[model samples]
Target: MPGNYVVVVVLSSLAALVLLLPPLFAAVDDGMRSGGKCTNSCGNVGFEYPFGVEDGCYRGGGFNLTCNHTYQSPRLFLGDGSVQVLDISVPHGWALINNTGMVFNSTETRVVLNRTWDQLVGGPYSLSGSNKIALVGCNARVDLRARVKVKHGGRGGDDDTGSNLISSCTAVCPLDLEDMTPVFAIGSGGSSAACSGVGCCQADINLDIPSSYTIQIHNLQELGGSISPTDLVFISKEEFSYTNDMAFGNNIPQALPALLDWYISSDPSECTYESAPDCLSANSFCHAYDLGYKCHCSDGYQGNPYIRGGCHDIDECKSPQDYSCYGNCNNTPGSHICDCPRGYERNASTPNGCKDIDECGHRETYQCYGECINFPGGFDCLCYHGTDGDPRKEGGCLPVKHHLSARDLGLFIGLGVGSGTILLLIAVGAPFLSRKMKDRMRIAVEVARALTYLHSAATVPLIAKVSDFGASRYVPINQTEVTNAVQGTIGYLDPEYYYTGHLMDKSDVFSFGVLVIELLTRKRPTYRTDQGDSLVLHFASLLRQGQLVGILDPQVLTEGGGEVMEVALLAGMCTRMTGQDRPTMREVEMGLENLRVSKKLASHDTASSSLVSQMAEHRMIATGDMEESSIQYSMEK
Candidate 1:
């Protein structure tokens, strides 16, 4: 009877336990469901709404994550089973995955690794910016090839073509350890940490992996007897450091983190609002990525953008640590504002968002030399220009020293003599400099105008292709003719005429451009250094590189003012690669004539102003003399 009672009690307890379990099971099941309300986590890694572990949990097939709990810890795998998922970010539209190790050949002389995107077809995943091909070892060479298969015809068609992109990188050890000593000194554990022309080298993988890509390493030569046969050449998402100990470690983890960019739409044409994926939430925008489309939350909002109503307004003012504000912080709907207090000001480089006004710092406004009293909004100066001493000290203003010793008087006389000499030199040299500048300008304008007239205005238009002023030929308009085979000066000869024996009006334009350059630079046309580089070529190169200032004559630049730039630009345009591109001689003449007229007008205006000033000064002196004479007459009477 006692045993029967115990059994009844156990049965009653089991029934109570069953009744309590249903609510708990329902709550757990709801948490695992997909969409915005679902729990988005696998083991220690956290994923967003677009990436989930179960069916109907993720946005699409490409974003699916398979949770394998058979191991000691749960592991999330990509749908293709080629990579293990590490982390996913909705804002960046990227996921971090683990890299696979390289496979060594039977002879150990070569290693190969591959990344395939076959399972990602018609999906939104692609290898993005975070990956790079790394080659590590002495005298290691890497051959990287990216191959993608494209369907040529319509659906179900057998037409297909493979496009391949090939590139290579080589890394070699230095001839001497001393050459690498500096690099080793700054590196951690005396390892060559940088991938720049050392035992390790890296090249960026810019192309997306659509079908497959391969990285093969060959020509692995040993450096010294200590070189390990386990040299690694692998694709890395994160940068790797090369150390001597890594070569000796058993089963070293070659897996590295790689970045994958994801999109919402499989077909690019369907990226429009009417055909967009249902996962894209409100306040989100779509962008083209690789062959598909990606969704991003608008600015000022941050959350799971692929979920309905997931993105929320960011309260910037509430998080003062994230937003910068010095005085008053005001938060708007999508942005924030920083304003200065009453006594402060705002500047481009204002520290901590606002700068306090220092009224005494501005000598022109406060005008204080001895003492300055500062208030909340304004300040007052105790002493001004005549006073001498520190501003903050009491009774600081004192009479300036006026008495002079014999040495001070001698110094004053020496300074006066020096100043007078400077004034005399300026007064004498200024006119000479001015005259020299005007003469150069006038000569340049006259030469250009003469060339223009010969090419266009004369009864028989002449092409002055020859360097000598005496040599010339007549050519009428609306005619294409070949000139007699004659060689002119080396640098001045037109390249087209020299090659094809054809001469045109543009041939003279080329010569004129060379002449202008020579005049500006004050150098001979055929001038060459020991390197056999001619001045014409040098000048052209300088102009092309925007270093015309370096080759310009110092005197011309100082005196020509803005006209120098105009002349340089005109010369550059005239020296075109082909005759058709060069400006006509008539155009050149008009440019020079305009520059000359402007210069003459400016000089005339300056002279007139100087004459007016002299006349005014003389009239004031004459009026004072008359007043003095009147006063003298009154005294005599």
Candidate 2:
């Protein structure tokens, strides 16, 4: 048993040791990969990965740099030369260098020429296409030449063709300084416009796989009568601003800022799987350039791509300017999640991703059956007008009861009795007039009821009523019936029917228009204005001139508000001079019905309040409660 136990213990210990070895080795490997002796910064500029001041730290010989410690502040240079390095971007693969310009002078016999350049043969650095070649001075000319790479040949050869000459420009001074000064003042604000061939000229450079390049400048005019100013030619980086003083004054810079592009390879072939070794970082990708390849961090990653575990996921929640999140934001690996608050929703139109949800627009979802008012994130529901309760639920609101005084009720009954007595006396005194008025009122009610039924059913079936066979005539559809005598009342007759002795449905429309005018004005159809014009004609004229308000009844003005004008306009259309010009009976009915519906909607609150008041008064009268504290009355006696 002891022998068996010993073998078991040995086996268990070896299993534990095997599991621990992998992580321990990984830690040591990570330390060795990150540990390197390198100076990362010089003066005010800093750089990382791929570019290093020490020999073994950089990725290749072309990326090697030197740090000069001879000055008060250390200065970094590209290779072992005087070309000082001002800035370097590792991810962008570009560097800014301080480069000097070439100057030329005029001699007694001829023009003296000068040339200045840095050899870029067999190196990672290439002149950026964004740089501009500028010539500054009177009658100055400058030429730029390059040795381009050839695809078929192993090495490039010098060529004097136009393709090799990348850029050239000439500058001339204006004879009148006064005129040029104003133009120069405006151009000095921008660099491209400032070099307008007046004492300065600029030309863009295009280099197609250049192995080497040179610049030469000389005076174009003969040096005989007047000695020209010292001519200068230089290359400037993208967006480098030039001013009038720099060209005219003696403040021209000895060196200008230049951009140099750097890449991984010089070969033009596409990269293979084996060539992706440079993008060893966890979240890095390899992109093919025109002449070589470059490494870049993935979409949500940032930092150096040439080193292992260099790129890191970005925290989008902290960057509000770049990534908008209105509500709670949670960051995850390589991405982020944004959740809007309770009553908000996603909207691209808003600056933030979230916007307030209009709960009132979607009433069913919010369970608000009554009046709903929307706020920022929530809504309020209540009974509109007078009744009170939670309007969000069905059948939650109820009508309230009101009371009136006993003395006020008595006074209301007395007025009713007196009005009835006066009307009874009038009816007895004028029996013929009263009968005619009653017959007309009955006819109008029947017509209104028929129109209401037709609209409610949404279908039209003719339902003719014959009050008097003498005045009624059957006219076929789409036909006119002629009569020897017009039988309608003088004030309500259609002018075309009376004059032409022709009758149609439009004749009834003209009479209805007169009736509508009488209803609104509370005047008889035969009533005339001071000018002796009939009510229909006067109403039409007043409606066209927007003066219907003066003739409208006080009751109509109080109840109709703005809607009265629409009805008046419809009446004017129905009362046109010719029966053919008037609207059909069906059209007049629809117009009146539409105006009525609009009025109902507009006065919804007011009508509700009035109904509640009337109901309360009836409740008081039924209960006979005179001294109740809650009861209210319009009159006391």
Candidate 3:
């Protein structure tokens, strides 16, 4: 009757398990040792490998740069500004970056990329999902699109030609955006109708030549552009000022920028696999890279062949310590034995790694029991801050506490349950308790206005479910079938209140006129045929058999003939079986506010064979004890 779907699934599963469970936090990881280096601000930029700036420090592939001395102007970043490293080359396999853009050729049609349709596998360095992305001026329009593929040369082509995926498209650009330039493309480019909306679109990648790749640009506009841009034909002409909300034809912009590709090893034998074998030791060797490879400690070993007393010992005589070795120390075979001596500083000293100082450290002869205080490669137990158990490092003085109120036991259990539920409902208010507290305060104000209109329409997901009350009543039936029997639901009832079950407010306007004919026919008004008839024929028999386009909903006949004759004359006055020829929800809310102020009516797509031959079902001009032409002022005492 009034939505008792098991009390809305036991109170929405106890309010989603007491508001979606709590205690979250867990991410510590301590193997810590980062990489990728930087250094470059403007002009002739060259930052290299996996790109970077002072995390683990870089020096490798894809020249990972990141040296922005807080830009009094230095800027280089790649892994922080979501991509901006700007230029690096080993003869250009491609990594000349800068918030690189390649929303798989901004589409108008077939374009989808949730990471290239969820990449299956047998993979090996690939990136190019069809391209074209220029927006340099003129009211710019770049509605992005992507849904790429071409795995291992499909359409049958290369790898001697053996990697099935084959072609895909969507690369548009231009809505009078004045000749845009600043390059962008990934997969199937060049012709397929100017592949990424003129401005020279292109996509024809055939990767597997082992080189990392990371592509992901789409809908990015933090007040117009700069997520990724650096295709290095020696700085693709300084580009970066096309900001009309960073174009996806002006929409999908949250913040974006992406591009990644960094490979030097394709692995063949640089070592061994199936997990640990040739981790090269006898003075490190194996190196090959084109399929995959590794190793090199030869002339002087360094550390880690994946570890287990992992390699070490390369100490020539460059002495920053005994490991940096200054004088006579050349050990050879990976010579991991000679550096470090003469004023040490190569990571400064373990805990933070590498060190060697002895200014006798703020000495009182190394202050043996308390204050040695030295730094940048040295000692500091310092001591003196109300010493208690500390000469330097002891239990010291602990007790501090202060910051405690997580709302002090939720304000003492809401003022002790608001003084025990108002003194136990006024000590259980004397018997039958005023008609059970007036039907529990009219079902708690109609379940709090139907849970505040379903929590303010939970941000519109819309499948539609209904019926909270219809002026509440269960079964006191008998006033002559309330004038011929009306309750509801059975092919969303209301064919004139299923031939009159009377009760009015137009019986909830004939159940919202069979829910706007089940939201304009995603069909379900009824269908059975082979003599089971009534597949809801009749909106006067599909308006006199002009079959109101086989029962409406080609999206409600493309909206606007006065909004489909003001919602089919409010589903023909909530199914006129004459309940005073229906109306009133304040005359169907003032005839949908004068069909939304007659915004030039012309739009109803279905319902017409002269619309139910201009509607007519007449009979109950109005009387009493309910033959409901809307109960003539209710008086049958």
**Which candidate has the top score in TM-score?**
2
Question: Candidate 1, after superposition: displacement of residue 86 in Å?
Answer: 1.7
Candidate 3, position 209, lDDT: 24
Compute the lDDT of residue 59 as modeled in candidate 1.
54
What TM-score does each of the candidates earn? 0.44, 0.50, 0.19
**lDDT per residue (tens digit) for residues 213-286 in model 1:** 44455655432323333445656576755564333343445466777776665556656763365435677777
Q: Where does the lowest 10-residue lDDT sum fall in candidate 3?
A: 1-10
Off by over 4 Å in 2: 1-36, 101-118, 150-163, 174-193, 206-211, 223-225, 238-249, 268-275, 324-330, 337-341, 346-355, 367-373, 380-637
1-637: candidate 3 lDDT, tens digit per residue: 0100000000011111212211111121122211112232344465322233443333223233445566665655433343444555422234544433232233221222222222212222223222223332111222222233335645765433222333222223333356544333222332122224332222333333222222222232223433232111000222222323322233222222223233334345534532323342344444554444444444455553322234566555455364543433555554434434444545422233446666445344444344343434455443322222343444433333322222321222222322212222222221111222222222222222222222222232111112213222322322212343344345544444445445433444444454444444434445444544343434424543335666665534644333553454456445445555555333443344344444566553232322322322221211121133222211110
Backbone steric clashes in candidate 3, count = 96
Per-residue CA lDDT of model 2 for 220-271, tens digit only, reads 5543424245555667675435565554445656567877787866654545
Candidate lDDT values, in order: 0.55, 0.55, 0.34
Evaluate residue 389 in candidate 1 and report its C-alpha lDDT on the 0 to 100 scale: 56
**What lDDT score is found at residue 623 in candidate 1?**
39
Stretch of 10 with least lDDT, candidate 2: 1-10
